[model samples]
Target: MKNIWISCAGIHDTLRFTFHSQLKVMLTVMNRRKLLLAFLACPILAAAPAFSHEGHGVSHVKTSVTLRKRRGRTLHLIVTFLNQGRDAVMLETVAVENAQVLNAVKTAVPAGALVEAPVSLRFHDDVPGIFTLMLDFGEHGKGPVTVTL
Candidate 1:
């Protein structure tokens, strides 16, 4: 009877030690999981600016143009627009020489839309003069539209 009691007590001690060790391991694992979760959430919270600048429900317009001088008498112009407002917008591009309209291109952009159009301007090889490229955005003309020559 004495030996049996001693053996039972030893088994109880081993089980208690195992339970404590397992409890510590579980706590460590849970803590690591929480830290990883927090790290993953930070980038998602910081990405608001990328999503908010895409027109949204308001009218925000942006324009960019690239001009490349090609061989002979042709100039390639690539124009792009992003409408950030809730309303549709019309865009017109006019090439002016001494305030005189030489050539023009017109298009309409829907709300929250992006448009990239390429236009080619041909000038006579002997035409050596300064010209103005104007981007007119209807009544919203001067604002919201950018011109690159």
Candidate 2:
């Protein structure tokens, strides 16, 4: 076999072109992966704030009552107040049936705190089986809670 001389120039060029084409395909795949990851992250980014502030932004006070005693037309109550706002609240006054009594010692409820106060309601006619109590939390807010008879 005499020295067979063959030109490898076309082979080298083909190899170089294949390598560049593969590189371009790899870069395109990488870009697509990045776009897919970004699309998947959108919902998680939007829901992050909702999960962090769950059950928050409640700016008003909540009130509940328990009947301590009932004698004739008078109903003694133990009113419970829950301040959900950021600032403290004061129970300024309580009104029932045209009678309003200013709290001598205002009940103070710290932020996110609960306080119980003794309240008496005297009905001139007849004490109903169930009644609604309206609480005045000064400038904070008002809560109207129903009391079972």
Candidate 3:
């Protein structure tokens, strides 16, 4: 057997250079991750105010079925109109899908007040399933309010 000897010159310098390069790459990756997270959080922080505030918009009418009861083929409902805006609203028409609206809709809802009225809906056959009620607030807005019979 023969003995072999190897040189150890510049071994420490090579190891130090490799360690420093690896450390720099690790720090760069960590900084990039932090920057990405900060960018993602910017939009969420900006939209925080919108989520906290409720009903922050122009004059609009909100409708809901406060009371609902079924008797024979006539489904009686108490529709409540909430004027959340500054101006008053006049309910022009109230139409029920798959049913005939029997009551007249000429009620005036004052500003920031709630107005409830009796709405009688006559179905062709029988009161069945959920239905949608369409309301028209003249010059203000119009939308559909889902109601379950």
Candidate 4:
């Protein structure tokens, strides 16, 4: 009877070990399948376009302004322009209220390229709350960008 009981205990232990090993393998395979499904769904999930800047003959003009610290009461304004178009476009001038246009220079830009044109405007005494920077494109339409500081 003692021998029979010892044999039964050994069999139960072996069964438990086999069950745990098989459960572990099943879980690992399930996790791997989930990871593969997630990886394959990435391109389908990212099919939509984020932002579209489609311009006609008149190129799209985007501007951004940044203010710098100055010694005197004058305020330094730096303007950046990005050309989102296919052809080359030129900027005529930039206007600001109560501020003089210090310099207007065009940086190197390629065809169908986005470029940055920096313009510095300095205020002598009074600073305007709102100002406008008009960009002239000869054949294309003019883009008037407003800035408020």
Ranking by lDDT: 3, 2, 4, 1
Better candidate by lDDT, 2 or 4: 2
Candidate 3, residue 113: the lDDT equals 94
Q: Distance (Å) between predicted and true CA of 99, model 4?
A: 2.6
lDDT of each: 0.62, 0.71, 0.76, 0.64
TM-score of each model, in listed order: 0.43, 0.54, 0.56, 0.49
Model 4 C-alpha lDDT per residue in residues 1-149, reported as the tens digit of each score: 01112234678876776677677778898999999998999877776353333454444556677775444545565656566767666666666656777777644434456666667777767667677877666555567777777
Going through the candidates in the order shown, the clash numbers are 4, 1, 0, 0
Best by lDDT: 3
Question: Where does model 1 exceed 4 Å of error?
Answer: 1-59, 98-104, 123-132, 142-149
After best superposition, candidate 2 residue 136: deviation in angstroms? 1.6
lDDT of 1 at 27: 83
Tens digits of per-residue lDDT for model 1, 84-149: 787787776555333333344677878878987666666654334444455666665544333334
Candidate 1 residue 21 C-alpha distance from true site, Å: 98
Q: After the best TM-score superposition of candidate 3, give how far the Cα of residue 75 lies from its true spot, in angstroms.
A: 0.9
Q: Model 2: per-residue lDDT, tens digit, 36-135? A: 9999999999999976653333245777888888788777788887877677777776766533333324788788898899888777677877767766
**Candidate 2 segments exceeding 4 Å error:** 1-59, 98-105
